[model samples]
Structure formats: structure tokens, C-alpha cells
Target chain A: MGHVIRTRTRASTVAAIVGAIVVLGLALLPLVAGRGLIQDMFFILTMLVLAQFWNLLAGYGGLVSIGQQAFVGLGAYAMFAGVILAGIDPVWAIPLGGLAAVIVAVPTAFFAFRLAGAYFAIATWVIAEVVRLSVAQWKTLGGGTGTSLPRTATRDIAGTGWIEAALDVRGAAARDILAYWLALGLALLAIGAIYGLLRSRRGLALASIRDNEEAARSVGVDAARLKWSVFLAAAFGTGIAGGLIFMQIARISPDAAFSVTEWTAFVIFIVVIGGIGTIEGPILGVLVFFALQKLLADFGAWYLIALGVIGIAVMLFAPRGLWGLISHRTGLELFPIRRRLITTKGNDHG
Target chain B: MSILSLAGVSKSYGSLKVTDDVTFDLPEGQALGIIGPNGAGKSTLFNLITGNVLPDAGRIAFDGRDVTRTPPMRRCLAGIGRSFQIPQPFDRLTVFENLLVAATHGRGQGEAAVVRDCADILERCELSARANDPAGGLSLLGRKRLELARAMATRPRLLLLDEIAGGLTEGECTALIRTIRDVHAQGVTIIWIEHVLHALNSVVERLLVLDFGRVIGIGEPGEIMASQEVREIYLGIEI
Candidate 1:
């Protein structure tokens, strides 16, 4: 007889199989969907990518940072520099954006790690402000006024021609589809990577740190090192998303690129309202957010007011968020990371 | 041979001294129980040895190496595992996950390499039924068992138990003592900080009495419990 350790559940297994089918459908959507629908899906996918990374940091890693815009802004700016200055294709420049975010994150983490709780959160915001201010001083990227990608770069971006010929769409529409596909790929990568990480040994260390830092340390979890790695990793993902976003928009400004409201606040809202720690939360959250935005787009300030009201209501009623409330009642885990022990009657020999 | 030694370790918070020049040596595989009143700095002493709180003075050596300034994680990796006076399970993580964290990180081994050992510990600690349950939802005894199981999962050479039996019922306490005794019988060194005198005496071969951050007595359990100074200070009985 032996005890067997299992991490996957029937529900999660079903969810995985279904998830692949859904992804296949989503990947094929642009073939028949209108430009408006494609653009909307792109928005939702990119936002989902951002929300997932934020969830990893605050939800799992116990790092609440409001300065994620630093990475977004730096990534967008780096893409701009690569395209306008280095003459690199906009597609090739996306990874450069991620690199820039990592470089900035090293120093940012050095200072922010010194603070805890609310102080840590505020320190991150202040660092973002500093990064924004510093980037505002770069005259070649049009200083505070900002600049757009060169027409040549956008028209000849990698993979757009094949997309155009294959789909029989115009260049602008092809670009939109290309960006949409990249966003889809990125969203998949972010969710897959985060899910895999949470199921690994490091994820256990992270959970322990989140639960009790002192006990986690006593158990030999190198909290500081793990946090540093998470921060840098999140920054890298966010930077690439930032670059992808700006490449799609073909424009960048310090204010727009570093907009806390756009990059950080909305992301936090998505994770908070969806569910903070669970991987499924952000996916659920981004969809709700998209629907709300579409329904309330005309109301202006009241739209924001509505979002605020909903966020507060969820926080009060379902502190774990909407998905948390659902999962609590149903006991359904779409991304089950917990391991189970089963006593099996068998020989000890392997 | 002594597995751990502290020499003149002192710690102060502002104007108040918590640990005053405490020094001791524990031979390998011995279970030494510490009995002290509230605010006696017994927990702080454990912290100093575990590297949670660095001493303002003196040195700590574990396994023949000076660990006076080593961080808590490093010391844990060096085979020093401890339980908090208050159970500190990863609230959202399952009880089994808690042990997995300790086993993987403390022993510097992969999860695949340690799962069977962790499961064995879970059964030994009588937590196999609640293995998949979230640690936060556990009862007092369950949490206590988790604290013990987590420490054991680390495969530690030196196990430090801090007030692990403080709030348990008599039957529960006995069961826990049996678990602790089993751990000791395996040749692991243990330094337990406990106020439950009878339970402490049943397991530990030696007893150390602490008062106002000072060690007032250290000897065989019978002699230390019977000493006038220990009775006056720890038992609060007038001489």
C-alpha cells in the first residue's frame, strides 16, 4: 500500500480540455468577425493579460504595487525608441519593451522592497511618477508632447502582409487582426505561465510567504529573492503588453503611456472584482469589465461612478471577488493548484 | 556533542531588555524544555537561535558554524526548524501544501523528491484526513498539529517547538506529546518552549527555568522543577 499525491481534479481536467477548444475558436474568430468585434476582443485579451500579471503580484506574491504603469510606460517608450531611433520593425521591438521594463524594475524593486504594506504600494506609485517624469525629458521621443510610429514601420510590420493576403483584408484591418492574435497569444502565455508557476514548488513558497512571511522564512522560503523574481517577471510581461498596445495605437505620450487610471487602476479593479488570487478570476473579470464599458460608454463620469460602485459592492459583499463567491458555493476550481494525498493499496516498489 | 550553542546573547527593544545575556548548549538529540512566565523572553530566545531576531550582543553557533548573523531562511536551510507559539499556517493553502513548502524549501529538495515523506509526516501528525483542507479552517488542535507537521516536514536536525501545547485539552495534549516524543526518539534535537509543566516534564530530559529574560535554573527535570529558585520564580510559590 502507498499514498498517492495528486494535484489535478476532474473539474480542472475538464476545464483544460474545454479551454483548449475555446482558445481554438477565439484564434479563428478574426477569419469571419467584423473589424469592430476583432478590435473589441483585442482590447479584452490585452486587458486580461495585464490583469493576470497584476493578480500574480498582488494576489499570489503578496505584493501590492500601484506603479505597474512604470513598466507599461517604459515598455511603450522603448518600443518607440526601437522603431523611430534604431529602425527596428515594430514587431521586433516588442521584446525590447519587455527588456526595458526589467531594467527599470531592478532599481524600482531595490527601493520599493524597503517598505511594507501601504508604504510599499505608495513607493511603487512614486517610482512610476519618477519614471514618467524622466521619460518626459527624452526630447527625441517628442518630449512631453509624445510621438507616433513611422508610417513605413507600421505599414511593413512583421506578419501583417501574410495576414492581409491570407484573410483578404485591407492593411489596417490586417494590422488589427495581427495585434489581436498577438494579444491572444500573450494572454494564453500569461495565464499558462502563471498557472504553471502556482502549481510548482515556488508557488508553494509564494503562498507560504503570502500567508505568513515569518513562518515562511523559518521554513527556508527566500521571500525577498522570490519577490524580486516575481516583480521582474511581471514587469517583463507588462512591458511587452505595453509595447504591443502602443504598436497597435501607433502613438505614445508620457501621460497616456503612464496613465495610472488606464494601466494600474483598471487592472486592479478587474482582479479585485473578478477574484484576486485565482487564475480564473482575471479571465472572468476582464469579460465583465468589457461588458460594463460597452453598456455604460455613453454615460461618461457616471460610467466610472458605476464601475466604482460595483467594485466597492464586490469588495464588501464578496471580498474574494465575484469568481470567489461563485467558486465558494460551487466548489469548482478551474485552476486547482492544491495537491491531494490518496492512500492506495499497492506494492511499495515503483 | 552539542548541536547548538548560544554565548552571551542579549537583545533589547528600545529601553526594555527582552533577552539578557542568555547562554546555553544543547547536546545533539536531546530534548530540552524551557519553562517561563509571560514576558520571560523564552520566545525571544528561540528567535535569537533561529535568526528571526539578531542579538544585540554575543554569538550563536549551530552545527559547529557561527550563525550569529545568518538570516532565518539560511538557518532553516541549515536544518533549524521551528513552530510559532501561535500557529501560522498559510491560511489559503491546504495543510498539505504548508508541509510541502517546508519540506521543499527547508530541505532544499524538489516537491517530487519530498511528497512521500510529507505524506508520511501528515499521517504521523494525524492530519491525513484534513490534508487537502485549507489551513485557516482548522481547529486549535488541528492548527497545532499542522505547526508540528510543518516543522517535521523540514527534516530538521534541530526542532524548536514554542508553546505548541498551550491551549490543547488533556487528551489532545497527550496525543501531541506522543507525537513530540516520537520525533525525539528519532534522534532529532529539540528545544521546546512550553508553560505546560507536566507535559514538558514527561518528554524533556532537562528543564531550563527563565525569569525576566534570565535563566534561573537548568538541570534534570526533577531537580530543576524541585529547586527553590525555580519554584519561587516559575511556579510563583513563595520560598
Candidate 2:
């Protein structure tokens, strides 16, 4: 007889199967769905990617940063710079944006790491503002007014022609299909990478750091190093999502690129209302967010007020978020990371 | 050879000296008990040794290497493990997960490599029943056991326990002492800060007494307890 430690649950295995089928179905949607639905999905998928990255930083790493707009703005701006200035295709330029975001995140973390709690959150916002202002001074990218990706660049993006030919769609519809597929891929990568990270040894260290930094250090977990890594990773993922979003919109202005309300606030709200710490939280949160927007967008300020009310109510009643409430009741984990010890007889694998 | 040595160590917060020119040495594999009145810098001494707090002026050598400026994490990795005076378990983590964190990082091993050892540590600490529960929901005794279990999981050559025996029932204290004895018998050096005199006496080979941030006496357990200064300061008995 022996004991085996495993992190998998029956529910997780089933969830994995269901998730794969759902992703496959969504991947095939662009083949049959109208352009309007495709564009809507592109929006949801990109936002989901952004929300997951934010959740990893704030929810898992215990970093509540409101300055994620810095990465989004920098990434989008960098992509624009690559296409407009350097003649790189917008698709290839997206990775350049991610790289640029990582480059900026190092210094941002160096400064923001000095602050704690709410101070840290505010410092990240301030840094984002500074980045936004500095990017606005670059006249080549239209400075404060911003610039559009040249029609030539978007019309002939690397995979747009391939998608157009394969899906039997016009060039405009092909571009939308291309962007939608890219958004879907990015969402999958973001969630997959974060899920992998949260199950590794570093994930355990991160959880400990989130619980108590001093105790974590006493236990030999290097909280500072882990935090730096998480911050940079979030910045990289956010930057790519930003680049992808701007590629779809084909426009870039500092204000539009770095809008805290659109990028940071909405992402935070999704993670908070969906569930902050769990992977399932942001996935569920983005859907709720999209539904609320579709239902209430015509009400203008009332929409914002409704969101605020719902946010406050969730924080008060279900503090862990909606998914948290559900998971607490059902004991189901789609992406389970908690290890359980099971006793097994000899030659019987667990 | 001494496993730990503190020479002329002093720490002051503002004008008040918390550790005033203290010096001590403990040979390898010896269990040394520390007793002191409130505010006598007992926990402060443990902090200084564990690298949680740096001294104003002194050298601290562990295993013949100077570690005065090493950070707490590095010190833990260097085989100096400690339990907090207050139980500080990672509240959201399960008890077994808590041990996994300590074992993996403290030993610089991967989870797959340390999971078995973590389970053994859990069973030895008698926390097997609560292994899957969140540490925050644990009772006081369970938390204390977790504190001890976590430090032990670090695979330390030296363990520093701070008032871990306090706030437990007599039976609980006896059971804890038995666990400590089992650990001590395995030859891990121990520096225990305990107010439970009988518990301290039963395990420690030597006793050191502190009063007002100064070492009042150090000797065998019986000799230190018999000393007039120790009796007056620690026992509060008229000499």
C-alpha cells in the first residue's frame, strides 16, 4: 500500500472535456456566424484575455494594480509604431507590442514594488498616466490626436488573405474573422498559461505570498522575486491583448489607448464579479459583463450605475464573487490546483 | 563546534534597547531553553537569530559562516527555521499545502520531490486529520501544531520555537513536548523560548535566563532555576 498526492478531480476532468468542445465550437463559429456576432465574440474573447491577466496579477499575486492601461496603451502604440513607422504587418507587430510592454514593466515594478496596499494600486495608475503622457508626445504616431493603421496594412494583414480564401468571405469580413480567430487563440493561451502557473511550485509560493508576505519569507519563499515575475507576465499578456484589440479597431490614440475605464476598470469589475482568485471567475465574469452591457448599454449613465450597484452587492454578499459562491456550494473545481492525498494499494495507480 | 554564535549583539528601537549587548553560543545538536520576563527581548533574540531583525552591532555566525546581513528567506534556506510567536499559517492554504510550501522553498526542491516528505511531516505532527482543511479555520492548538509542523518541514538543522507551548491544555502540552523530544532525539538543534518551566526543563540540556534585555544567567536546567536572580526575576519568588 502507498499514498499518492494528486491535484485532479472527477469534475475537473469532465470540465476539461466540456471546455475543449466549447472552444472547438467557438473556433468554428466564424465559419457560419454573421460578421456582427463574430465581431461581438472578438470583443468578448479579447476582454476575457485581459481580465484573466488582471486576475493573475491582483487576484492570485495579491497585486491590485489599476495601471494595467499602461501596458495596453504601450502595446497598442508599439504595434502602431511597428506598422506605420517600420512597415511590419499588424499581426507580427502584435508580438512587438508584448515585448515592449515587458520592457516597460521592469521599471514600473521597480518603483511600484516600494509601495504597499492602496499606495501600490495608486502608484501603478500614476505610472500608467506618465506612460500615456510620454507616448502622447511622439508626433510620428500623431501625438495626442493618435493615428490610424494605414488601410494597406489592415487590408493585407498576414493571415487575412488566407482566412478570406478559406472561409469564402470578402476582404473586410475576412479581416474580422482573422481578428476573431486571433482573439480566440490569445484567450486560450492566457487561460492555459495562467492555469499551468497556478499549479506549479511557484504557484504555491504565490499563494503563500498572497496570504502573508512575512510568513512567506520566513518559510523560504522569495516573495519579491515571484511578484516581479507575475507583474511582468501580466504586462506581457495585457500588451498582446491591447495590440490585438487595436488591430481590430485599426485606430490608436493615447486617450483611447490608455482609457482606464475601458481597459483597467472593466477588467477589474469582470474579475471581481466573476470571481477574483479562481480561473473560472474571470471566464464567468466576462460573460456576465457582456450580457449586462448588451442589456443596459442604451441607458447610458444608468448602465454604469447598475454595474456599480452590482459590483458593490457582490462584494458585500458574495465577497468571493459569483463563481466563488457557486463553487463553495457545489465543491466543483474546473481547474483544480489543490493537492489531495489518497491511499492506494500496491500496483494500483491513483 | 558551535552551530550558532552571537557576539556582543545589540538592537534598539528608538532609545530603548531591546537586545543589549547579548552574547551566547550553542554547540551543535544541543537544545537550549530561553526564559525571560515580558519585554525581556526573548522573541527579539529569536528574530535576530532568524534574520527577521538585524542587530545594531554584532556578528552572528551559523555553522562557522557569518550570516548577520542575510535575509529571512536565505536564512531559512541556510538551515535556520523558526515558528512565529503568533501562529502565522497561510490562512487560505490547506494544512498539507502549508507544509508543501515550506518544504519546497526551504529545501529548494520541487513539489513532486517533496510531497511524500510533506505527508510524512503532517502525520508526524499529528495533523493528518486536518490536512485538507484551510489553515485559517484551525483551532489554536491546531495552529500551533501547524507552526511546528511547517518549521519541521523545512528540514532545518536548527529549529527556533517561540512560545509554542503556551496557550495549550496540560495534556496538549505533554503531547507537544513528546513530539519535541522525538524531534530533539533526531539531533536537530533547538532554541526554545518557553514560559512553561517544567516543559522546558524536561527537554533542554541547558537553560538561559533573560531579564530586562540582559542575560541574567546560563547553566544546567536545575542550576539556572536554583539561582537566586533567576528565581527572583522569572519565578517572582522572594529570594
TM-score of chain A of each: 0.98, 0.98
lDDT of 1 by residue, B108-208 (tens): 99877887898889999999999989999999999999999999999899999999999999999999999999999999999999888888889999988
Looking at candidate 1 chain A, the ten consecutive residues that score lowest on lDDT are A341-350
Please list the residue runs of candidate 1 whose C-alpha ends up more than 4 Å from where it truly belongs after superposition.
A348-350, B235-239
Q: The CA-based lDDT of model 2 is what?
A: 0.92
Per-candidate interface DockQ score = 0.81, 0.68
Q: Each candidate's chain B TM-score? A: 0.97, 0.97
lDDT for A183 in candidate 1 is: 95
- Candidates in order have lDDT scores of 0.92, 0.92
Q: How far out, in Å, is residue A168 in model 1?
A: 1.3
Instruction: Count clashing residue pairs in model 2.
Output: 0
lDDT of 1 by residue, A1-350 (tens): 67666878899899999999999999999989999999999999999989999999999789999999999999999999999999999989999999999999999999999999999999999999999999999999999999999899899799999999999999999999999999999999998899889888899898888888989999999999999999999999999999999999999999999999999999999999999999989999999999999999999999999999999999999999989999989989999887876667784332
